[model samples]
Target: MRGRTLNDAFIILDEAQNTTIAQMKMFLTRIGFRSKTVVTGDVSQVDLPKDTKSGLIDCLEFVDKIKGVKISNFDSSDVVRHRIVRDIINAYDKRKK
Candidate 1:
């Protein structure tokens, strides 16, 4: 990760919540000069194994307090889909618990 350098690149990592913590650390450390990275994922929705820790959740714990990193969280109010979609999501969440 440290061996390579990316300059002026915009890196967007999707489905990052499924990544392992070790992989998240590697991706973060790979940032090079003038590179901007956006790691977007819902901590509540992880596709990894049941016992595995989400990389997105773990990474947020470490970098959320950093000065340059900005973390934005969206709720159902921000959902762009129909209301039924949000309700379906809520139902799934409820079922998980």
Candidate 2:
């Protein structure tokens, strides 16, 4: 079946930390017309194989300079979850350093 164009829509991609750069490119290329796409992930908490690089990380490092692009880096303070959850996230984040 032919795929319909994603025109005049807003798309949020969750759990994108496991996606490779190629996959992210393919997904972004699917957008059409006035669509807005947001790809989100935690680079420090990637679950992919040890040798793999996250697409989200690549974009964070390289794509921000592109015109009309916006990147929002959320911190533990941005968490709306229970206090324990935020603490757990902060703990894990610290372990990565």
State which candidate has the highest lDDT: 1
Write the residue-wise lDDT of candidate 1 on 15-77 in tens digits.
Answer: 899999999888888887889999889877798999999989888877977889998888766
Q: How well does model 2 score by local distance difference test?
A: 0.82
> Which regions of candidate 1 fall more than 4 Å away from where they truly are?
92-97
Per-candidate local distance difference test: 0.86, 0.82
TM-score to true structure, per model: 0.85, 0.82
State residue 45's C-alpha deviation in candidate 1, in Å: 1.8
Q: Name the TM-score of candidate 2.
A: 0.82
RMSD of each: 2.0, 2.3
In model 1, which residue pairs have backbone atoms overlapping below 3 Å?
A: none
Give the Å shift of residue 10 in candidate 1: 0.4
For residues 1-97, write the lDDT of model 2, one tens digit per residue. Answer: 1355688999888988889888777777777889998888887678988898888777778778889788888889999989998999889889989
Could you tell me the C-alpha RMSD of candidate 2 in Å?
2.3
